[model samples]
Target: MEHPLSQFKYCPKCGSKHFNINNEKSKQCADCGFVYYFNPSSATVALILNDKKELLVCRRAKDPAKGTLDLPGGFIDMNETGEEGVAREVLEETGLKVKEAIYQFTLPNIYVYSGFPVHTLDMFFLCQVEETSHISAMDDAADAFFIPLTEIRPEDFGLGSIRQGLVKFLSALK
Candidate 1:
């Protein structure tokens, strides 16, 4: 896979072709003394467990791995914390208001969008719904359902980072 910032040929600030990679995570503009850092974007996912201990999962409705299983989450928007992002994504995708969310863990992921490798930091949260009986799939989720944690196969997740996170989540259960 190519670097996330490999598509950037010219400097955005100075509009010069002299922009060059200063290192793996940054670029420098020779003409205007401008430096750009390619930091990983932050994303959030919710691990909502019901009373039965079944975990909520969603099916993607769009590509970059559409039709694959995923946790209810999305990229964290500017000005929002990871916890807030998880709550918002959960409501948008599952239509369930988050009562509370606790920080679980974070994993680095490479999210390919439109064939561009955008790196991300996926922060997972353990949460519960205010109303479990009323869940309707919305937004980019084609469907959302709960499944036993033991039955979840990491390979079923199309996103490599998600699969890795699931494996860690399962291992922590022991």
Candidate 2:
């Protein structure tokens, strides 16, 4: 795996070429004495189940995993809590207003964006929606729908963290 800061050739603080690896997770600028840390971005994943125990799923609309199965969630925006981020993401991607978002487990992920790996800590949540009948694929989701839990294959999920998280979730239900 490439270091998260491997692509950076100059110090962001000083724009100097003297930037060098300070440690496993940071870099230091020899010229300006500036230290930059690469921390995992906070992300969210929603686990929405309908009355029939069917899980809500979406299809990726863009690259990185275009057309592959995904959950409805995304990176937490500035100043947003995990719960708020999950609810907002669900609404944006599936048009479903989250009534509740219960905290669950978390998984570390490496999301490749713009040809660079973005390390992320994905916070999973069990979400309840106000309405399920009006779901429409929106935002980054190309398509969205509910699928029977028994019929879901974790391998079909495009993201590694999602696949791992799904396996853990299913195992917990057993």
The TM-score values for the models, in the order shown, are 0.96, 0.97
The number of the candidate with the highest TM-score is 2
lDDT of 1 at 95: 95
Model 2 gets an lDDT of: 0.96
Show model 2 residue runs off by greater than 4 Å: none
lDDT of 1 by residue, 15-91 (tens): 99999999988999999989999988999989999998888999999887999999899999999988899999999
CA displacement after TM-score superposition, residue 45 of candidate 2 (Å): 0.4
**C-alpha local distance difference test of each model:** 0.90, 0.96
Worst 10 residues of 2 by lDDT: 1-10
- lDDT, residue 17, model 2: 97
Question: Could you tell me how far off, in angstroms, the CA of residue 56 lies in candidate 1 after the best superposition?
Answer: 0.2
Clashes of each: 0, 0
